[model samples]
Target: MKFLKSGLEALDEVTVIALGSNMAGGYPSSEALLEAALARFPGARLPVLARSGWWRSAAWPDPGEPEYRNGVALVETSLRPRAVLEALFSIERGFGRTRGAANAPRTLDLDLIACGREVIDAPGLVLPHPRAHERLFVMGPLAEIAPGWVHPTLGRSAAELVVTATVGADAIPI
Candidate 1:
């Protein structure tokens, strides 16, 4: 961790993380699994500052599967973007999330939506998640928690993006 002249970590970044789940696995319900996953953020060094209530939406590409429970989290942390991504992946794994088919039902899905104002496009990481701004499941909850959060690249607030989100339009707070 790099300390600034004022004693703040260079990585004192308040970030947005999007959470989603459709399969409960062993938990009683997907919503319960989501709550459990949020509880782990603090242990991962990403303490949750605020979070939106869980929203529900039919599974995309195949509504025949299961409905998804999604929400957004605002966390205060000292971890850089890459480390934040790693922590999210680790949390997902600890919840029995398996990497298999695309769009498959998942026990937990944690996405690093934005890391402050930094813009990064790496092989396995992308700041402000590439398509997050286009998904209502991601944006609606975000607008609920942080309406003024601006997309690093697009320069649009979460409230603005929610109106035009093309995907996940069926999402509604549950």
Candidate 2:
């Protein structure tokens, strides 16, 4: 058995998937995003953490709406980063995520290229979340699962970033 050897060598990188769902209505949330991902990727080993409290962040130029309920997940998969990203986007679209806003409250969002063992700043993706070190909501939940996973560029771990980033000071654990 022979393998195709191109300029790009066989990349053996682990996948770190992040899942986030949006809240619908004012009371009974109509969005069901995370549950759907779980159904699709069963036996996923990453810890699924969530935060229910919505924070009033700068809206992403969409229709001004309610704050967003966000969370993060750390998954381990063999699929390449791009492949995983596509899968996540498909999941987001399934939950009604439109590219209408830069920071709008969404029904569901699955940011697949959050972090990895190495730093990757590509055209469409930036590893370690690029802003992971700045967002508490992401750091908090990511810390729960990948405390030891270090940031390729920052020389820090998820736990460190979460504590350093105070944005999630009022995150409601769910």
Q: For each candidate, C-alpha RMSD in Å?
A: 5.4, 8.9
- Kindly list the per-residue Cα lDDT of model 2 for residues 81-137, writing each as its tens digit: 666677677766665678775665667767764534656778887775666577665
TM accuracy, model 1 = 0.92
Off by over 4 Å in 2: 1-14, 25-32, 42-64, 113-115
Which lDDT value does model 2 have at 35?
52
lDDT of 2 at 56: 28
Backbone clashes in model 1: 0
Best by TM-score: 1
TM-score of each: 0.92, 0.69
**Runs in model 1 lying further than 4 Å from the true structure:** 1-13
Clashing pairs in 1: none
lDDT of 2: 0.53
Clashes of each: 0, 1
| lDDT of candidate 1 at residue 142, scale 0 to 100 | 83
Cα-based lDDT for every prediction: 0.87, 0.53
What is the C-alpha RMSD, rounded to one decimal, of candidate 1?
Answer: 5.4
